[model samples]
Target: MSMEGFSKVFEMYEAFRELSLSRHSIREFRDTKVPQDMVDKILELAATAPYASGKKNWDIKVIDDTQTIQAIADSIEAYTTALAPKIREDFREGFIEYSQSFIAFKDAPLLLIPTFKVNYSLSLMVEDEAIKAWERDNYVKSIATLSMIIHQGAHALGLGSCYMTGAVIAQEQIKKIIKIKPRHDIAAIIPIGFKKER
Candidate 1:
Protein backbone atom coordinates (compact mmCIF):
# COMPACT_ATOMS: atom_id res chain seq x y z
CA MET A 1 0.00 0.00 0.00
CA SER A 2 1.12 3.56 -0.66
CA MET A 3 2.21 5.80 2.24
CA GLU A 4 -1.01 7.80 1.90
CA GLY A 5 -3.13 4.66 2.27
CA PHE A 6 -1.16 3.52 5.32
CA SER A 7 -1.58 6.95 6.96
CA LYS A 8 -5.36 6.88 6.43
CA VAL A 9 -5.65 3.39 7.92
CA PHE A 10 -3.54 4.34 10.93
CA GLU A 11 -5.60 7.50 11.51
CA MET A 12 -8.85 5.59 11.43
CA TYR A 13 -7.52 3.04 13.92
CA GLU A 14 -6.30 5.79 16.22
CA ALA A 15 -9.67 7.57 16.13
CA PHE A 16 -11.48 4.34 16.89
CA ARG A 17 -9.19 3.52 19.81
CA GLU A 18 -9.45 7.01 21.24
CA LEU A 19 -13.27 6.96 21.27
CA SER A 20 -13.37 3.43 22.70
CA LEU A 21 -11.10 4.29 25.59
CA SER A 22 -12.50 7.75 26.25
CA ARG A 23 -16.18 6.87 26.07
CA HIS A 24 -17.23 5.97 29.62
CA SER A 25 -20.12 6.59 31.96
CA ILE A 26 -19.05 9.79 33.71
CA ARG A 27 -20.56 10.37 37.12
CA GLU A 28 -18.18 13.13 38.10
CA PHE A 29 -17.84 16.52 36.44
CA ARG A 30 -15.83 19.67 36.96
CA ASP A 31 -17.52 22.71 38.47
CA THR A 32 -17.01 24.62 35.25
CA LYS A 33 -19.89 25.24 32.83
CA VAL A 34 -19.99 23.96 29.25
CA PRO A 35 -20.44 26.60 26.54
CA GLN A 36 -23.91 26.78 24.99
CA ASP A 37 -22.50 26.75 21.47
CA MET A 38 -20.55 23.58 22.11
CA VAL A 39 -23.64 21.90 23.56
CA ASP A 40 -25.73 22.97 20.56
CA LYS A 41 -23.08 21.68 18.14
CA ILE A 42 -23.04 18.28 19.85
CA LEU A 43 -26.83 18.07 19.70
CA GLU A 44 -26.83 19.02 16.02
CA LEU A 45 -24.29 16.30 15.29
CA ALA A 46 -26.33 13.79 17.29
CA ALA A 47 -29.44 14.65 15.25
CA THR A 48 -27.58 13.78 12.07
CA ALA A 49 -27.23 10.16 13.21
CA PRO A 50 -29.12 7.73 10.91
CA TYR A 51 -32.69 6.68 11.60
CA ALA A 52 -34.95 3.86 10.38
CA SER A 53 -37.37 4.65 7.52
CA GLY A 54 -36.08 8.24 7.62
CA LYS A 55 -38.02 8.88 10.80
CA LYS A 56 -36.31 10.90 13.54
CA ASN A 57 -37.68 9.68 16.82
CA TRP A 58 -35.29 11.34 19.21
CA ASP A 59 -36.11 14.70 20.81
CA ILE A 60 -33.64 16.31 23.19
CA LYS A 61 -34.36 18.75 26.00
CA VAL A 62 -31.51 20.75 27.44
CA ILE A 63 -32.29 21.79 31.01
CA ASP A 64 -30.18 24.50 32.60
CA ASP A 65 -32.41 25.97 35.25
CA THR A 66 -31.57 25.09 38.82
CA GLN A 67 -35.19 24.86 39.95
CA THR A 68 -36.12 22.51 37.13
CA ILE A 69 -33.11 20.32 37.75
CA GLN A 70 -34.01 19.93 41.41
CA ALA A 71 -37.54 19.06 40.39
CA ILE A 72 -36.26 16.31 38.12
CA ALA A 73 -33.97 14.89 40.79
CA ASP A 74 -36.83 14.89 43.28
CA SER A 75 -39.11 13.13 40.82
CA ILE A 76 -36.43 10.53 40.12
CA GLU A 77 -36.03 9.89 43.83
CA ALA A 78 -39.75 9.45 44.37
CA TYR A 79 -40.18 7.11 41.41
CA THR A 80 -37.24 4.94 42.42
CA THR A 81 -38.44 4.77 46.01
CA ALA A 82 -41.79 3.34 44.93
CA LEU A 83 -40.44 0.35 43.02
CA ALA A 84 -40.97 -3.23 44.26
CA PRO A 85 -38.86 -4.13 47.30
CA LYS A 86 -36.34 -6.43 45.65
CA ILE A 87 -35.73 -4.23 42.64
CA ARG A 88 -35.62 -1.09 44.73
CA GLU A 89 -32.82 -2.36 46.93
CA ASP A 90 -30.71 -3.41 43.95
CA PHE A 91 -31.08 -0.04 42.22
CA ARG A 92 -31.31 2.30 45.20
CA GLU A 93 -27.71 1.76 46.17
CA GLY A 94 -26.44 2.61 42.72
CA PHE A 95 -28.77 5.60 42.50
CA ILE A 96 -27.41 6.97 45.72
CA GLU A 97 -23.86 6.43 44.55
CA TYR A 98 -24.53 8.14 41.24
CA SER A 99 -26.19 11.06 42.96
CA GLN A 100 -23.15 11.60 45.11
CA SER A 101 -20.65 11.20 42.27
CA PHE A 102 -22.26 13.94 40.18
CA ILE A 103 -23.78 17.10 41.47
CA ALA A 104 -27.51 17.50 40.87
CA PHE A 105 -28.29 19.02 37.48
CA LYS A 106 -28.47 22.40 39.22
CA ASP A 107 -24.88 22.13 40.30
CA ALA A 108 -23.60 20.56 37.08
CA PRO A 109 -24.68 23.45 34.80
CA LEU A 110 -26.00 21.19 32.01
CA LEU A 111 -28.56 18.43 31.64
CA LEU A 112 -29.72 16.71 28.45
CA ILE A 113 -32.83 14.59 28.17
CA PRO A 114 -33.36 12.46 25.07
CA THR A 115 -36.87 11.30 24.25
CA PHE A 116 -38.27 8.84 21.69
CA LYS A 117 -41.57 9.74 20.09
CA VAL A 118 -43.96 6.85 19.47
CA ASN A 119 -45.51 7.06 15.99
CA TYR A 120 -48.16 4.33 15.73
CA SER A 121 -51.92 4.30 15.73
CA LEU A 122 -54.46 1.54 16.23
CA SER A 123 -56.75 2.97 13.55
CA LEU A 124 -54.44 2.03 10.71
CA MET A 125 -55.24 -1.14 8.72
CA VAL A 126 -52.90 -3.48 6.88
CA GLU A 127 -54.56 -6.14 4.78
CA ASP A 128 -57.73 -5.89 6.92
CA GLU A 129 -55.76 -6.35 10.14
CA ALA A 130 -54.96 -3.45 12.53
CA ILE A 131 -51.48 -2.10 11.89
CA LYS A 132 -50.67 -1.58 15.56
CA ALA A 133 -48.19 -4.47 15.66
CA TRP A 134 -46.22 -3.34 12.66
CA GLU A 135 -46.23 0.26 13.84
CA ARG A 136 -44.82 -0.73 17.27
CA ASP A 137 -42.02 -2.78 15.69
CA ASN A 138 -41.07 0.11 13.47
CA TYR A 139 -41.14 2.52 16.40
CA VAL A 140 -38.76 0.34 18.37
CA LYS A 141 -36.37 0.05 15.44
CA SER A 142 -36.34 3.81 14.97
CA ILE A 143 -35.64 4.48 18.65
CA ALA A 144 -32.75 2.01 18.63
CA THR A 145 -31.19 3.75 15.67
CA LEU A 146 -31.59 7.17 17.32
CA SER A 147 -29.88 6.00 20.49
CA MET A 148 -26.80 4.63 18.73
CA ILE A 149 -26.47 7.77 16.67
CA ILE A 150 -26.78 10.17 19.63
CA HIS A 151 -24.26 8.34 21.79
CA GLN A 152 -21.72 7.98 18.99
CA GLY A 153 -21.96 11.71 18.33
CA ALA A 154 -21.47 12.47 22.01
CA HIS A 155 -18.37 10.26 22.12
CA ALA A 156 -16.88 12.03 19.11
CA LEU A 157 -17.35 15.44 20.73
CA GLY A 158 -14.88 14.69 23.57
CA LEU A 159 -17.64 15.21 26.08
CA GLY A 160 -18.25 12.50 28.67
CA SER A 161 -21.86 11.42 29.25
CA CYS A 162 -23.70 8.78 31.24
CA TYR A 163 -26.99 7.31 30.02
CA MET A 164 -29.44 7.51 32.94
CA THR A 165 -32.33 5.09 32.73
CA GLY A 166 -33.21 6.12 36.25
CA ALA A 167 -34.54 9.31 34.75
CA VAL A 168 -36.78 7.33 32.42
CA ILE A 169 -38.60 5.72 35.33
CA ALA A 170 -39.97 9.13 36.26
CA GLN A 171 -40.82 10.00 32.69
CA GLU A 172 -44.27 11.44 33.24
CA GLN A 173 -43.20 13.68 36.06
CA ILE A 174 -40.11 14.67 34.16
CA LYS A 175 -42.15 15.52 31.12
CA LYS A 176 -44.43 17.71 33.20
CA ILE A 177 -41.55 19.45 34.90
CA ILE A 178 -39.53 19.79 31.68
CA LYS A 179 -42.61 20.73 29.65
CA ILE A 180 -42.04 17.96 27.08
CA LYS A 181 -45.11 16.76 25.23
CA PRO A 182 -46.97 13.63 26.34
CA ARG A 183 -46.27 11.88 23.04
CA HIS A 184 -42.49 12.05 23.51
CA ASP A 185 -41.10 9.27 25.70
CA ILE A 186 -37.97 9.84 27.66
CA ALA A 187 -35.18 7.45 26.65
CA ALA A 188 -32.10 8.71 28.50
CA ILE A 189 -30.83 11.67 30.51
CA ILE A 190 -27.27 12.89 30.06
CA PRO A 191 -25.57 15.56 32.17
CA ILE A 192 -22.59 16.82 30.21
CA GLY A 193 -19.66 18.87 31.45
CA PHE A 194 -15.91 18.54 31.96
CA LYS A 195 -14.95 15.28 33.66
CA LYS A 196 -13.65 15.33 37.20
CA GLU A 197 -10.51 13.30 37.82
CA ARG A 198 -10.67 10.62 40.48
Candidate 2:
Protein backbone atom coordinates (compact mmCIF):
# COMPACT_ATOMS: atom_id res chain seq x y z
CA MET A 1 0.00 0.00 0.00
CA SER A 2 1.16 3.58 -0.65
CA MET A 3 2.06 5.79 2.36
CA GLU A 4 -1.00 7.97 1.80
CA GLY A 5 -3.29 4.91 1.61
CA PHE A 6 -1.82 3.51 4.87
CA SER A 7 -2.33 6.82 6.70
CA LYS A 8 -5.98 7.07 5.55
CA VAL A 9 -6.71 3.51 6.65
CA PHE A 10 -5.13 4.14 10.08
CA GLU A 11 -7.17 7.31 10.57
CA MET A 12 -10.44 5.55 9.87
CA TYR A 13 -9.49 2.69 12.19
CA GLU A 14 -8.64 5.13 15.00
CA ALA A 15 -11.92 6.99 14.62
CA PHE A 16 -13.95 3.80 15.01
CA ARG A 17 -11.76 2.66 17.92
CA GLU A 18 -12.41 5.92 19.74
CA LEU A 19 -16.12 5.70 19.10
CA SER A 20 -16.26 2.29 20.80
CA LEU A 21 -14.28 3.44 23.84
CA SER A 22 -16.17 6.70 24.21
CA ARG A 23 -19.26 4.86 25.43
CA HIS A 24 -19.91 5.44 29.15
CA SER A 25 -22.58 4.96 31.80
CA ILE A 26 -24.41 8.26 32.25
CA ARG A 27 -26.44 8.82 35.42
CA GLU A 28 -27.32 12.49 35.24
CA PHE A 29 -29.58 13.71 32.46
CA ARG A 30 -31.28 16.90 31.33
CA ASP A 31 -35.06 17.51 31.26
CA THR A 32 -35.16 17.16 27.45
CA LYS A 33 -37.30 14.50 25.84
CA VAL A 34 -35.76 11.53 24.03
CA PRO A 35 -37.32 11.18 20.59
CA GLN A 36 -39.37 8.06 19.91
CA ASP A 37 -37.36 7.34 16.76
CA MET A 38 -34.12 7.33 18.69
CA VAL A 39 -35.58 5.00 21.33
CA ASP A 40 -36.75 2.62 18.59
CA LYS A 41 -33.31 2.61 16.98
CA ILE A 42 -31.59 1.79 20.29
CA LEU A 43 -33.88 -1.19 20.91
CA GLU A 44 -33.47 -2.39 17.32
CA LEU A 45 -29.69 -2.36 17.56
CA ALA A 46 -29.85 -4.02 20.99
CA ALA A 47 -31.96 -6.81 19.52
CA THR A 48 -28.97 -7.80 17.38
CA ALA A 49 -27.38 -9.28 20.51
CA PRO A 50 -26.60 -13.00 20.23
CA TYR A 51 -28.69 -15.62 22.00
CA ALA A 52 -28.46 -19.28 22.94
CA SER A 53 -30.24 -21.67 20.56
CA GLY A 54 -31.05 -18.57 18.50
CA LYS A 55 -33.95 -17.84 20.82
CA LYS A 56 -34.52 -14.24 21.90
CA ASN A 57 -35.68 -14.55 25.49
CA TRP A 58 -35.49 -10.87 26.32
CA ASP A 59 -38.35 -8.37 26.62
CA ILE A 60 -38.41 -4.64 27.37
CA LYS A 61 -41.07 -2.48 29.06
CA VAL A 62 -40.86 1.28 28.66
CA ILE A 63 -42.35 3.25 31.56
CA ASP A 64 -43.17 6.91 31.01
CA ASP A 65 -46.42 7.56 32.81
CA THR A 66 -46.39 9.92 35.77
CA GLN A 67 -48.65 7.69 37.86
CA THR A 68 -46.50 4.66 37.14
CA ILE A 69 -43.32 6.52 38.02
CA GLN A 70 -44.80 7.66 41.33
CA ALA A 71 -45.98 4.11 42.04
CA ILE A 72 -42.50 2.77 41.42
CA ALA A 73 -40.96 5.36 43.67
CA ASP A 74 -43.46 4.55 46.37
CA SER A 75 -42.77 0.84 46.11
CA ILE A 76 -39.06 1.41 46.40
CA GLU A 77 -39.57 3.56 49.47
CA ALA A 78 -41.79 0.96 51.11
CA TYR A 79 -39.34 -1.80 50.37
CA THR A 80 -36.45 0.22 51.72
CA THR A 81 -38.39 0.88 54.89
CA ALA A 82 -37.88 -2.71 56.10
CA LEU A 83 -34.09 -2.57 56.07
CA ALA A 84 -32.17 -3.10 59.32
CA PRO A 85 -31.53 0.08 61.29
CA LYS A 86 -27.80 0.14 60.63
CA ILE A 87 -28.20 -0.75 56.96
CA ARG A 88 -30.85 1.94 56.66
CA GLU A 89 -28.56 4.55 58.14
CA ASP A 90 -25.72 3.58 55.82
CA PHE A 91 -27.93 3.99 52.76
CA ARG A 92 -29.85 6.98 54.14
CA GLU A 93 -27.30 9.55 53.05
CA GLY A 94 -26.46 7.66 49.88
CA PHE A 95 -30.13 7.07 49.15
CA ILE A 96 -30.79 10.80 49.36
CA GLU A 97 -28.03 11.37 46.83
CA TYR A 98 -29.27 8.51 44.66
CA SER A 99 -32.80 9.86 44.83
CA GLN A 100 -31.59 13.17 43.47
CA SER A 101 -29.75 11.35 40.70
CA PHE A 102 -32.96 9.66 39.56
CA ILE A 103 -34.88 12.93 39.50
CA ALA A 104 -34.20 12.75 35.76
CA PHE A 105 -36.54 9.78 35.36
CA LYS A 106 -39.42 11.87 36.56
CA ASP A 107 -38.18 15.23 35.29
CA ALA A 108 -36.75 13.98 32.00
CA PRO A 109 -38.80 12.01 29.46
CA LEU A 110 -38.03 8.26 29.33
CA LEU A 111 -37.49 5.19 31.48
CA LEU A 112 -37.18 1.57 30.39
CA ILE A 113 -37.10 -1.82 32.04
CA PRO A 114 -35.43 -4.78 30.34
CA THR A 115 -36.50 -8.26 31.38
CA PHE A 116 -34.85 -11.62 30.63
CA LYS A 117 -36.62 -14.96 30.81
CA VAL A 118 -34.54 -18.01 31.67
CA ASN A 119 -36.30 -20.93 29.99
CA TYR A 120 -33.55 -23.46 30.44
CA SER A 121 -34.38 -25.89 33.22
CA LEU A 122 -32.03 -28.11 35.16
CA SER A 123 -33.08 -31.71 35.51
CA LEU A 124 -32.75 -33.41 38.90
CA MET A 125 -31.44 -36.63 37.33
CA VAL A 126 -27.68 -37.26 37.66
CA GLU A 127 -27.53 -38.10 33.97
CA ASP A 128 -28.73 -34.60 33.06
CA GLU A 129 -26.21 -32.80 35.31
CA ALA A 130 -23.76 -31.94 32.54
CA ILE A 131 -26.47 -30.69 30.23
CA LYS A 132 -27.97 -28.59 33.02
CA ALA A 133 -24.64 -27.00 33.83
CA TRP A 134 -24.07 -26.10 30.18
CA GLU A 135 -27.56 -24.63 29.93
CA ARG A 136 -27.05 -22.47 33.03
CA ASP A 137 -23.76 -21.10 31.71
CA ASN A 138 -25.27 -20.40 28.29
CA TYR A 139 -28.27 -18.58 29.83
CA VAL A 140 -26.09 -16.17 31.87
CA LYS A 141 -23.65 -15.51 29.03
CA SER A 142 -26.50 -14.72 26.66
CA ILE A 143 -28.07 -12.20 29.06
CA ALA A 144 -24.74 -10.42 29.72
CA THR A 145 -24.10 -10.19 25.97
CA LEU A 146 -27.56 -8.69 25.45
CA SER A 147 -27.06 -6.03 28.15
CA MET A 148 -23.70 -4.95 26.68
CA ILE A 149 -25.16 -4.51 23.21
CA ILE A 150 -28.11 -2.53 24.55
CA HIS A 151 -25.95 -0.20 26.64
CA GLN A 152 -23.49 0.37 23.80
CA GLY A 153 -26.25 1.17 21.32
CA ALA A 154 -27.78 3.72 23.72
CA HIS A 155 -24.39 5.41 24.21
CA ALA A 156 -23.80 5.58 20.45
CA LEU A 157 -27.06 7.49 20.04
CA GLY A 158 -25.91 10.30 22.41
CA LEU A 159 -28.51 9.27 24.98
CA GLY A 160 -27.65 9.04 28.67
CA SER A 161 -28.54 5.86 30.59
CA CYS A 162 -28.17 4.33 34.02
CA TYR A 163 -28.57 0.59 34.56
CA MET A 164 -30.60 0.39 37.78
CA THR A 165 -30.35 -3.17 39.05
CA GLY A 166 -31.75 -1.93 42.37
CA ALA A 167 -34.96 -1.28 40.51
CA VAL A 168 -34.98 -4.91 39.46
CA ILE A 169 -34.72 -5.94 43.08
CA ALA A 170 -38.18 -4.43 43.43
CA GLN A 171 -39.39 -6.93 40.85
CA GLU A 172 -42.67 -7.74 42.56
CA GLN A 173 -43.70 -4.09 42.68
CA ILE A 174 -42.53 -3.54 39.11
CA LYS A 175 -44.36 -6.61 37.86
CA LYS A 176 -47.56 -5.48 39.50
CA ILE A 177 -47.27 -2.01 38.00
CA ILE A 178 -46.28 -3.20 34.54
CA LYS A 179 -48.57 -6.28 34.68
CA ILE A 180 -45.77 -8.51 33.37
CA LYS A 181 -46.37 -12.19 32.83
CA PRO A 182 -45.56 -14.78 35.51
CA ARG A 183 -42.66 -16.14 33.49
CA HIS A 184 -41.00 -12.74 33.10
CA ASP A 185 -38.61 -11.12 35.59
CA ILE A 186 -37.22 -7.61 35.74
CA ALA A 187 -33.56 -7.56 34.66
CA ALA A 188 -32.65 -3.91 34.63
CA ILE A 189 -34.29 -0.48 34.62
CA ILE A 190 -32.49 1.90 32.23
CA PRO A 191 -33.45 5.55 32.61
CA ILE A 192 -32.64 7.33 29.36
CA GLY A 193 -32.50 10.99 28.38
CA PHE A 194 -30.15 13.72 27.13
CA LYS A 195 -27.00 14.27 29.19
CA LYS A 196 -27.00 17.54 31.12
CA GLU A 197 -24.03 19.67 30.11
CA ARG A 198 -21.63 19.95 33.04
Best by lDDT: 2
lDDT of 1 by residue, 21-54 (tens): 7677766677777778778777777777676545
**Model 1, residue 30: what's the lDDT?**
79
Per-model TM values vs. the true structure:
0.75, 0.75
Question: How many collisions per candidate?
Answer: 0, 0
lDDT of candidates 1 onward, in order: 0.67, 0.70
Residue 179 shift from truth in candidate 2, angstroms? 2.3
Worst 10 residues of 2 by lDDT: 99-108
Instruction: In candidate 1, list every pair of residues with a backbone clash.
Output: none
Residue-by-residue lDDT tens digits, candidate 2, 56-139:
777777776757876776776566554434466766777755544433344445777777666665544445867877866676
Per-residue error for 182 in candidate 1, Å, reads 5.3
> In angstroms, how far off is 153's CA in candidate 2?
1.6
Q: For residue 39, what is the lDDT in candidate 1? A: 82
Taking all chains together, the TM-score of candidate 1 against the true structure is: 0.75
